[model samples]
Target: MSAPEPVVVVGAGPVGLSAALAAHALGLRPLLLEARTRTAERPGSRAVFVHRATLDRLDAVRPGLGTEIAARGLVWDTRRTLWAGRQVHLRTYPADPATAPFTSLPQTVVEDLLRRACDEAGVRTLWGDPVREAVPSSEGVRLRTASGAVHGARHVIAADGARSAVREAVGIGLDGSTSATEFVVVDVADGERPARPERVFHYRHPAAGGRHVLLVPFQGGWRVDVQCRPGDDARHLAATAREWLPAVLPQVPGPEVTWSSVYRFQLRVAARFADATGRVLLTGEAAHLLPPFGARGMNSGVGDAVAAARAVRDDAVEAYARERRTAAERNVRAAGAALDHLLAPRPGLRLLQRSAAVAAPLWPRAGRWLDAAPYGPRIRKVRY
Candidate 1:
């Protein structure tokens, strides 16, 4: 038998790790490449919420993987939305007890768990080596590292994130819009009073001049997101978060910020997930970007990686593009609605939002229409 063509995966993030694991499950050896010496050491949780569909996809790659993740992550079915200190909407996702509706795990932990899985599957990772040049040829994709070392692969999975060097080398482009409102995330710990373990969203805070604050519970602390005016400074964000975080997470007393991050989020997707030869592929933030409102960013990317690997193995990479594109469109729409609801500067929109929030609490039956960002419609599985 001829030597098996190598399958190379770029980036060691969750998407990259998942891609490698998926390929290994399909009887293919995968080489993972990462520019960084190690995973990010950021203090706050980057992406936490993992949806049911994502868990299902992960289980497909490795049997019982979803159960293990669910055991480590936070699983919830109810989220409460408050406007002006009044509980407006108490949305609940009633699902079968066997399958949790949603789960939340820190991005770093997720990556670490995936890396362990890769190790068990005998996948090799080259740390501190970034793929510099990617030349797509009929035979395969020829890649050159930043150190000038050359490697050849039958195909490539680009999971290098939004600032993907591999995507640039292969000339793949993404399109999306950035919201006008800026979001600052801060993870804080309060030993005196622990934060409530629930998804709490405060919209139209009186002290913040109707701005929004989102609070999600993590393992040891609460990850707080403060909506700020465009181009706000860090000092302003810090002070604002310190003053108003309690409005959303009232139980926390004397909160101490451990790590904070400021970023401009967008909703973007690549023109295509795969090249014409199906040799070059994109996954995770490399393929698309969506705000964290519905926990769509990293969660959706995991799905992309799993589907891409299966498609690549089955010689039907186009199916990955078609199925993922549909999901991206749906997620983009959900993100837009969430962003608008978060920052309803317009009088008419603000009134509509307030009415919906009230409707949810008053008539729980009306919540189906008041969902700011529902956990998306069911995505059809791509049969590769």
Candidate 2:
């Protein structure tokens, strides 16, 4: 295969965009393909947290993106845990001047910034032409778009989301299971929250009926997540938030709902992150799936993009697969452990949560580890 051959990037979401941008930085041509005519401008917020390491990855691939994105989003360090209407653990992320802080922004804003970066790089992106199928052979892989136009590439990066067509075409299988917890995500415009700017997670909220409610502030509003039973009505977010959030945060004057959704979180890992010949790779949700907790899904996906591109440039796709799978398994374990603490019917687990909340103030480090990744810090590169 020739180095000049374009690496076809399927999916134009953050993962795909990062992959394309990273490929360009690695001196490889990236031809991006998006099923949608335009980028997502959804009213709802999904995968909104951009961790410190992720900001560094973005800036490395595209100069000044990290600073620009941080400038446009809201950064918060302190996260408090509450139970029965009282503050328990006030966990704080200490200032690390060497690295970028964690940031929160709407999904639309993230996409818009990425789109601008793509334009700046002069990367080729084909919109309205979804990748329908990928035919791999000895020479290269041939991609058939939804419009039936065939494009040939030496390699393909599949960031087409969890339900990836390229993954199905290449015959990859996921190994994990979907969680039973159904989460109702509510995005409210200009919702009422504390003036200090922080994150609040409540367990057994009174109005929420023993379930958890995560309150996160965005650029101009707050995103409230209410844990509901599988059989609960998903459409009643307004009523549920009014009942639970008001009891928890008295400062909320009125929450105007912008968007809402109820989804069953899943803990899934692809059997492989790359093909046998190492010509195709999966990034972001295409490679793994985890609950939205800890903000690992999209952030980790961005990591996948950078790693995959570097692997392609280095001619070591297998290493990329191993390192990414390791990261996915790590994140999955953390998210699962946290979920277990949140929903484990055992009273002992409840006591643990409550204890951590109460003890966090005196022993701040106790609360710090409660809401952290089970493995370690975000894995940036694979060291052989």
Candidate 3:
């Protein structure tokens, strides 16, 4: 009797963990490899929003995994949009009885839950073993780790993020454009008083020198994104958040920043999601990179992980490559549109935004447009 095929998953982020669990459920032996140790510090409240579709994918891997995550995150019922210190739109919906539409929690917490799921499934994980080289043949993939150890995998699922060693080793390249706007993202601890659990987006904040700012509530804190104009110093802005943040967010009293960083986001997709031998498949940020405007990055990556596992189990790499790349393209386009709307780079777009703001008081539809435009035609448009 032959042994069960071995599917090796690279990286130990949410995506890799999801892939490992999915593979195990699909009756395949899975091995997970992480460059970082178990105690590595994962900084920042990255990828706070987890969509319902993402939860559905995780549930398919394990019966109660999605429920565990949903229960642990925040589900804000209010969404507000403002223009130049004036509220343009405000909408609140009643919470669902059975399940929330989505959940907001730190990516670190999600990863912790995913890691726990992997452990429960008895998935083998090797820490501190980064893959330095990956050579694929018609039969399988040969992976050499930083520890000078070689691993032969029946199939390799690459979820090592944008700077993926496995993707590079397989000779896949990402192609897309980057935003001109420098964005400063910060996570702040929950403050005292008046700061309601809601999501707010301000176009041209009056208090912050007319820059754009978005405040989203999560489990224990808020993830804030401030868009910087040309020549603005992101580092300087992040350093002095306490000063300007208070003025912009009067609802929060003396909010303390937990994490802050500058980012010039990219919209990219891999040329191919699989190698020529069909022995290596890319998932998560390894296959695509989208701006965080629509919360498309991590959510879409989860979908990729589940699909990749199914492909490996069914021996249908080419089909996986085609379908996932198509999904990546749609997500890139949607995120790009959202970014463009937020930046308003051209005179026409700026004029349109100003016109919409002026008309918002008289026309509710205009306000709704302003509120929804930043999220890019809803997730159904992408159909991922």
Candidate 4:
């Protein structure tokens, strides 16, 4: 058949926007469709970390977009880890102004920047018109919107998030597992930056009844993740943040909670990244749902976005399906390892952690390991 033309992208999220931008850079006309309007109220500070490679990908698609994000977000150079109120690790690195390792900002803010870039690039986005159905054939695909309007395209990139209608229409299924333990995440707006200005992780924090808590700084506030035991009530913990949060961080008493969520982390990946006809491809959360431990969720989605666009541009849709699914599987493995270490430490790992904490005072490597263990193993770079 003729080469796919007038590429259609489902969803106006960061990944979808990136796909459109990448398509534009590759000289393909793209039409973006989103269910939400421009003024939708997206609440929470979801996906706060953006890796350097993701920024590079965005900058390659549209110059200076990455720089803009870095400027708007905070970059913490210091990392601190504590075990039962005793400091196990404290290290700081020199800053590099040329290129930041990552940027910490709210997902909404990043989406805004991406949408702005789309506007500047003249990418047409049809808002409030979500794709309700997708039918693919040997030649092309046809999409039916929420308003019952039908649109035809040579190819479709589905990035409409976890509950993707397009994915169901294409008969693709997700395979993986979710944890039973719940994690409560809270976003607090801080009037001023904390004195430490570092990313901190606690193992059995004394103030929070020996539960693990992670404190990370974003552009305008802090994200606190509290790991709840199986019997513990995560929703109650989030609901009572005003009372208990101060104990976790004495520095920020009476914190202004902007958003909170109780998450049952999952490591699911789509069974197939593309439809049988190769006229529809999945990207971002539509393809995978990773635990947020190592910040692999959106970063991997961004990678999928650019790769999907390039695959369509080069007429290598099958290759894209295989490679991206492999990447997602690797991400799921890495994230699973991290989750196992953090939430489900076995007896052996528990002993190792305790020993590491005790030896950290004298052995620097032990301290470093304690600081880095929660993030799990890093994967080799894969081209998007």
**Which has the greatest lDDT?**
3
lDDT of 1 by residue, 1-384 (tens): 233356889988888988898888898788888988875454667887766777777788887777677778765556777667777667667534357766776877777778888887789888988888888776788888988877788888889989988889878889988776677788877456654567777766676666677777765677787777755674577656667666545678777777777766698988888876778888889988888755677888887888878887897778878888877777777776666655666899767666777777668654544445333323344211
- How much lDDT does candidate 2 score? 0.78
Q: How many pairs of residues collide in each model?
A: 0, 1, 0, 0
- Candidate 4 TM-score to native: 0.96
For 324-344, candidate 3 gives per-residue lDDT tens digits of 999999998788778877878
Model 4 CA deviation exceeding 4 Å by range:
1-5, 192-194, 379-384
The alpha-carbon deviation from the true structure for residue 111 of candidate 2, after best TM-score superposition, in angstroms, is: 1.4
lDDT of 2 by residue, 1-384 (tens): 233355888999889999999999998988999998884445577877787788889999998997778777887777777666666567567534345467788867888899899998999988988888897765568888888788888888999999999999999998898877678888767644445567887767776776677888878777787777657776676445656555545546665667777787789989999987688899989999988765688889999999988988898888999988998888887667666766755789667666776777688775665544222333444221
lDDT pick, better of 2 and 3: 3
Instruction: Assess each prediction's global lDDT (C-alpha) against the native.
Output: 0.75, 0.78, 0.88, 0.87
When summed lDDT is taken over every stretch of 10 residues in candidate 2, the lowest stretch is 375-384
User: TM-score, each model?
Assistant: 0.88, 0.88, 0.97, 0.96
**Model 1 quality (TM-score):** 0.88
Which candidate gets the maximum TM-score versus the true structure?
3
